[model samples]
Structures are given as structure tokens and as C-alpha cells.
Target: MTKTLPLRSYQFFLSIIFLLFSAPLLAQDEGEEEKPKLTLGGALRFNYNLSSWKDGQKDRGGDFGYDMFRINAVGTYKNIFLNVEYRLYSEAFGGGFLKQGWMGYKFNEEDQIQVGLTQVPFGLQQYNSHNWFFNLTYYVGLEDDHDMGIKYIHDSERIQYQLAFFKNAEELQFGSTSEIDPSRYSYDIAGRNKEINQFNGKFIYKLGKDRNHQLGTSVQYGGIYNLDTKETGDHHGFAFHYEYLGEKWNVKAQGMIVDHNPITPDTISDNVLQFGAYGGTYGVAADFNLYSLAVSRSIPVEIGPISNLEFYNDFGFMDKAEDDFEDSFMNVTGVLITAGKVYTYIDYAAGYNHSWLGGNYVDDFSAGNPDAKWEARFNINIGYYF
Candidate 1:
């Protein structure tokens, strides 16, 4: 089973070449060349781990693992585009097996009308679910894409909106009264793959004449009506990114505010268990023409004593605590403490992460408020785009 994202240097180079060559093809008759009708593309990705534990022990499978490979083909015709992806999950998914053949459809470039299973485009990093680079990766709060459903998108050149309605994507859509729907979902929730119909909306607004600054927000509302009970909730997220471009200097900052009713997704039934979390995510990047480095930080609100609901059970821990932060729980104060938790945890481990290369990180903390914590992640992807 492979679980890495492939690098596409050749395909990327070809894409550049094709973009330039397309000029002549487009000049022939506008639509006479048939736009090539088909495109060939694929990537080879690998990952090796060098961490003791982020969640737990990775040695459970092995110390180092390169377990993902993706091969895909994309086609476009007029305003319709089709993308099909093949995947090979590691032994973690199904004992070193092969699971590919996911298809998608996009209409008007903004709205995607897809079938089969695909990635759930919700957050900035979550879209990179297929891990080919195994290091410190980010996993957003969103469902996996391989479920079955038909989603509609509302996006254009700058502003974008995504509204999808679907059931589980892995299994067949169940009748409104199907008992298996809830039972299957109880274990992995994939059973309802798009089986649980939903409505999701995502929008982005770009500002500044040069289009260097933008604001985006994502909101979702829907209820899961399983065989036994009807569970429903709402999720809202607000994000903004601003950047100043200069010949030899570049400054930028971006952040998001996430608030979800009934914080946990599994059991939206606990009315008192309603949750609210907010954090500031920002970063900076500087360069001298050819060389550049950009670092950004994202700290989400995971403050809650109530561990999130996963599938049909509580399979996780809450990291926000005061006396014995060891046991994860909800932040009693329900306030934002971006760095306190990290600092305390670091102190507990007797380790420190210093600021280097113009990279300075500070956690939002309050004096003596031990439970005040934030999940701030600062990352720098210093690589050439081309």
C-alpha cells in the first residue's frame, strides 16, 4: 500500500511547454484544434518519517514508510472537465492493498459536479490529504473525499463558493429508512459515504487591485438522518490573507476564525456539549529574487474537555488541561490561548523550538492560566514554485 504524493517535474515541465505551445493551437480556429481533448499526467511521491511521535508511534507499521503512489488522468471539453485518480493506500488502510479509481467532474470551472469518490476540498492544507511528503503534515477538520456524492461549486476568477449535497461516497446511497446506514457509519462512518446527504458552502473574496490580498469564508449546514435518529449541526469558518509585494521584500499575514456548533461531529446530539473555538493564523515570507522563504502559522481552537466524537466512540484526547494537562479535555474558560499550551507542553518535555531565519513564533497565553492553550503550527515551505 502506498500513501505518498508523487512529484510531477516532467508533467509540470510539459504543462509549461503545452501552455506555450497552445498559443499556436488556439490561433488555428479558436475551437478547431479540439483543445487536445485529453491530457496525460501522473506523479511519483514518497515519504520517510523522522519523528518520535506526533500522534503516537509510527513504528507500529515501521520506523520509515513510503506507502502512497497516485496515477491520474485529466480531460477537458468546453466547460466540462473530468479528473480520475487512482490510489494505493498503505497497510494502514487495508493491509497493503490497492484502492484507486476515483473520478470527478467540474462544470464552469467553479462548480464541480463529481461522481464516485474524491478529495473533500474544504481547507487550505486538507486538500493535500494524499501524503507523498512524510514530515509534519497538517490535517484539517473535514471528512475524507473517497465517499460517493454529487457536489455543486460556485467559483470564478477571484471569488469562489462551494455548495455540495451528497450522501456517503464509498457505499451505495441508502433509502431514507435504511438501518444499515447508521450501523455501518457507527464503526467507520464511511458506510454513509455520501450516504448522509449534506449541504456545504465555501466562498473566497479577493481584494486589492493587484489581487495580492483576499478574504475567504466557509460555512456548512446539514443534518444526518440515519435509520435510528436525525443528527444535525452547523459549521462556520472565516479566513483572510493579505500580502504586500515588493522588488526585494515581501510581507504577508493570513488567519482564520473557526466556530462550530456542537464542536464534535460524531454526536451532534449533546446539546450542552456545544463548542466554540477561534485562533489567529499568520506568517511571513521574504526573498532576494531567486531565493525566498515563507513561514505561516495556524492555531485552531481545540479547547474543550469533551473529546470530539469519532465515528461511534471517543477515540481521541483533549490536550487543554490545567493540573494534569496529560488528559485532553475542553478548555473550561473557552478562551483563546495560542501559545500557553505549547509552552507548558514544551516545558513538560524540557525541549525548545527557537526562532531562526527571521522566524519568530509566539503562543497566545495568559499568566498562570495553565489550561489556556492553542494549537499553533508554524511551517515554512521554502522551495521554488517553478
Candidate 2:
């Protein structure tokens, strides 16, 4: 199915764009601040990968490539705010993708509303990872998840919550190619076509005297459609998260259960899971669980200009709904070095019963074959934020 922005999304974007450029002119009052507060920021990332398969397969072996580049702009006038982010280039999605651009107002400290393309507050905020690849949940549409919608957020000392409604979640604009499939990360569910409206809510609590510990819960509901059979389905999920950020060490974990039910039994594809939830496997109407855990700590040791050094380990697991599809998991041990606005990650990743990408089960990793059950990759990712 071709992805296109809905009328509402287009309006929201254009309206913000207009106001951002014309706000100064519209401020006719001489005493009032004629120029809005503007902030410009972005990041550039590059990645090099050396991957080795279990059977010594040479196809898609290794490469050094451009990860992505993004530019961010924020303009604020009193309680009104505008935020825009654009992906200038990427190898996977090709030329670019619109990450997010939203406008909002802060009625007060406790209440605010935003409309446009923004994150879907589900699961862990950005997945439990300090690496470039993040976790399997990201490939399955559970992390870095954004959509066009409106959200109401309430924040206080002890409680912070969000209520949101989104349409066309993770809409892809440039499309995909054979070598790089952008759809794998796209937020389109299987057997889902029309509308794909989603409603989500998240609540978090700060505990402990320092308020360094946070616990959160999330819920999501959406209507699905089958582009081929014209059938409808239902999607629902719930997640729980916990994190503790301390001076020396930080740890976070999140788990979620999702149920996908289709009205027509034969309306979905059994070969390709909808929205690339799983690689080459199918889960039309099923329930699955996703889990992620990460822990990291800073060391006093420094190297060259790198003043802050951290060692981390991240583990993620996915339990498919059907037993025929074996579960997949990944373990990544890495070091993160930070110097100013530049961060470098050197990581070694291992996958079991799955490819390094963690989309589908690997048949090569059969029950009896010891050598076939695992694959590994060594990667270096460097990014500079400005």
C-alpha cells in the first residue's frame, strides 16, 4: 500500500511552517518580543559493520555506510512552541524521511497539548540500548515509534502522563528498495489498511527520596484493516517499564504484550508478518511478548580527549505467538565514550535463533546444530550533536 499523509497531518505541518517563518512579521506590537526564541540542533551519525554468518556466508557480508543525518529547529514564543526535525539522508530509507514536526502550547506547567507528527509513547521511550541498532523491538515497530496525532501531557513532581490519538503511524514517504527495506521499520500493522487509527496512554511515577527511580505503564488500542481482503482487525497492547538512573550506574527494562486479532481468518499473509514485525514469518492474529534490559556505568578511566567512558550490556528477547516460529534474542556488550557533543560506540553483538537484525527466526539455527545457532557482528558508530 502506498503511504500518504492525511489531510490533518498536512495541515498541521503547513500551519506550523507558516507560523514559524511569519511569526516576527505578525508581531506588530513594538514592546512585545518581535523575534521568537529559536534553537537549532542536529546530529550526524556514521556506522561501520563487520558481520559474519554461522555458515561463513559471504552475501551481504560487511560494509561501511552512512547511518543518518538529521536537523532540528525549535521556535518558542511565550507558551507557544514549534519543533521540526528532518532527516537529510539515510541509506535505508534513501534520500530522507520526515521524523517529526510538531507545534504545541503550554497552558501551564501541568498541562500542554501538541499536534502533528510525534512519538507514540509506548514501551520504552527509545528502546533499551546504547548502540546504533537499538533493540529488536525497534525493528518490530515498538521503539522510536512516531505518528501523526495530538497528545495531551500532564506533568507534576510525582506523576507524568500522556494521552494521545494518532493516525497513519510511522508513515513512510520515500518507499523502500530490495537492498534496504524501510518497511521493516515502518509502523504499518499487518492486515491493516484503512485509517489505522491508534489511541495510546502512558503514565510514569518518580519514586525514592532522590526521585531517581521511575516506573511507567503504557496502553494502546487501534483498528486494523486488510488491504487485500478488505477485512478488519483489532490491535491492543500493554507495557510496563522501570528505570533507575544513578550517578555511577543506570539500568532500565520494559516488557510488553500485544494481541492482533483479525475478523477474517484468511485475510492476512502467513508468509510475511505484517509490517515486518518478523522477518519472513507470519503472525496474523496472535499474541506476542517483547522484552528488553540494559545496564551501563561510567568509569573514571579516560582515553585521549574522551573524558567520559561507559561500559554497557543490552539484552532483548521476543516470544512469538506461534511455536512454529522459534523465539529470537540478542546480547550486545559495548563501550560508549563521550567527549563534548561527540559520542562513540564500539560494540559486539550476538544473536541466537535469529539474524543480527532480529526480525525472524533463522532456519540454519536448527535444534541440533551448535554452529548454526549463533551469528555475530562488530560495529563502530560515531555521532556528533550540534
Candidate 3:
């Protein structure tokens, strides 16, 4: 059963925005030293999806939905800065929220440290997909991942690096549930065994005469604490990233393997392995490997509302640790049309052996039969950032 978001909570969320926006006017008389510069911005998105399953069932063509709304506040004064982002999701699976909140201090031009919730430095970091649904690594918790932690970052002409230690991974689910709860992107592994005592590090080096080429590597280690068993699950991850940015073309790729120690093979289940949550599906496998690549080129011409356009194709693949499990692949061809603050993504995505690419294909995985499958989705994502 689904319930509407609480009225009081929604009102409070709006009130905070109003207060933040009005604060500058209320303190116009304050000195510059005391009043930090405040900037408020965010993005609103909507998605219309048409999905086809392996069984030949097609969803209604006009399956329109309010995807998400985000509000960001940034305050900077001297060497100190604070950032906060609040996100409100529409009621489909249930209204879940809260994205990012952190504070940082810059010691000098090339060094800084941040505390509170921030993104985990892993895989491709920001990712390279124009589609609203990213790649397999994202669904399995390896890309665009965030956690509550402290991070130190260093940047220079030739090298950039990040070292972070986190207390716990961020929670995505909203209520208390003993049952498996899967979100659109990833499932809540923290629900059963929270990821704690996490450490992540990454290093990047600039190459080539134009300095437009980059090569990087990342490592992550964390412990999962099972509330019921009072046991610990050890997780380790390693990856390499490469990217080249030219005048009108860009290419990005990443490959990583995430391994969790002590997974019993018999524990694998449909609900557990689909989203690839730690305590769920991955808990039954020793490890999984993921690879992603994307190439895109910017178009010179512009359309009416579309000031600029770029075409892109993204490819991703995943393989489980056990030899019996079949490998999965996802291929997405899309275009991004940008107009000032408004950006829209028009995509056609298809996949084989895994439903995590889109639609309801993942529910069919089994040990006895080799599940030969085909699934696809036509997705349009429109967003305005302000």
C-alpha cells in the first residue's frame, strides 16, 4: 500500500526554501564578513516511459510521471563553504527524499576537506550517460554513490586525487521494513546490514599534449553489519577510468569489480540479486564485474527551443562471480537537447540477459534454465535547472 506524503513535512520543506531565499533581504544591513554569500538552485524533472517486457506485454505509451524535484543551497564565506540539497520524489513506489548536505573548508588553492554527506569517489564519479537511468554500476551501488563521510581532495595541473572515510552509506528507503525494498535505481541494502566504516580513494592523471585526456583508478573498502546475525560482510572494490574530451567529441569508460567476502551461494534469490544490493543479491555471490562506456559528439546546429544538441551512445555489461549466472548487457542510444537551463534526453535503450537495464526483465533469472531475454524502453527525460 502507498500513502501520500505528510502535509506538515511538505509544508516544512517549502518553508525552509522560503526562509533561505528571504534571508539575504532580511540581512541586507549586515556586514560582508558576517553575511555569507548564498545561492539557491535546483532541478525539476519529468519522465515519460514506454516499456516492453520479454513476455510481449507493453506498458501504456503515455506513462507520464513527475520524476523528482531538488533544491540546493550553497553558502560561501572566505575559505568556508556549506552545501545542501533536498530532493522530493513523487509518490510511485513511495515518497523518498534527501540527497546531499555537507560543509567544507579550503586550506589553500589546491587542497580542501569536506564533512557531512557527500559523493563517494568511485568508478566514473559523475558518470557519462545522457539517459535518466544510468548504467548497471549505478544500480549495483558503484557509480554516483554517496555516503556520510569526510573527504580530502587535492587538485593540480597534472594530478587530482580524493581520500575519504565514511561512517555509513546514505539511506534511500523511507520506512522500517523487514521485507526487501527496492527503489527505482537501487535497493536498500542498509536496511538489513548497513554499510559502515567505509573508505574510498581515487587518483587521476592528465595526459596528452592537449591535456584533454585523463586516466584514473579507484579503490573502496567497507564493512556491512547484519543486524540480525550480528555478523560482518567485507566488501572490496577496484576500478579504472579513462576519458578524452576533444573540441566536439568526448569518450568515457570505466571497469570495476566489487567483491563481498563470505556470500553463500544458496542464498541467491530473485528479490536479492535484481538490484544487486550488498546483503541481498550480491550477498549470495562472491563478486561482480561491471563495465561502462559512452561516446558523444556535439552538433553545430541549433533547433528552436533547443539551443544545442548532442548525440550519444552508452554501453554497459555486468557479470556475476559464479560461473552458472549469465552475463548481462545494456545498450542505450540517446540525444541530449539543451536550451539554456532546460535540458531534455530522448533515448532508446535495450538489453539482454538482465532487466536492470529497464522494465521487468530481472524477475526471470533462475538456475535451471538459461534465461535468453530481450527488453527495451523508450524514455524521455526533461529537466529545468535553476
Q: Best-fitting candidate, measured by lDDT?
A: 2
The segments of candidate 3 whose C-alpha lies over 4 angstroms from its true place after superposition are 1-34, 54-60, 171-188, 262-286, 356-369
How would you order the candidates by TM-score, starting with the best? Answer: 3, 2, 1
lDDT of 1 at 80: 44
Write the residue-wise lDDT of candidate 3 on 1-386 in tens digits: 11223456446545544544454456455555664799999999998877775234353345777888889999997667899887777555345545678887766689877777788888776765656667666656676666777788898889999987776656545334342433323333433555657778999999988878999999988766554455566678999999888888889898888776433234533223223332234322336788889888998666676777889898887777667866677788999889989989999888776544443333422121264666788889999999
Clashing pairs in 2: 191-225, 192-225, 279-359
Model 1 agreement with the true structure over 184-221: per-residue lDDT tens digits:
11112221111244345566676677654545554544
Q: Global lDDT of each model?
A: 0.32, 0.69, 0.68
In order of lDDT, best first, we have: 2, 3, 1
Candidate 3: lDDT of 52? 70
Q: Listing every candidate in turn, what is its Cα RMSD in Å to the true structure after a full C-alpha superposition?
A: 17.1, 6.2, 9.1
TM-score of 2: 0.79
What is the RMSD of candidate 1? Answer: 17.1
Error of 3 at 88 (Å): 1.5
Please provide the root mean square deviation of candidate 3 (C-alpha atoms, Å): 9.1
Model 2, 1-386: lDDT tens per residue?
32333578547645655654455455446676545799999999998787765234345566777877889999987768899888755443445666778888776789877878877888767556766668766656688776777777898998889987786565544232111123333344533333366778999999999888989999998766555545556678999999888997989899989876555446534323444321232222256788899999988666777788889998988776765655667788999889889998999988776544423343311121234456788888989999
Q: Backbone collision count in every prediction? A: 37, 3, 1
TM-score of 1: 0.45
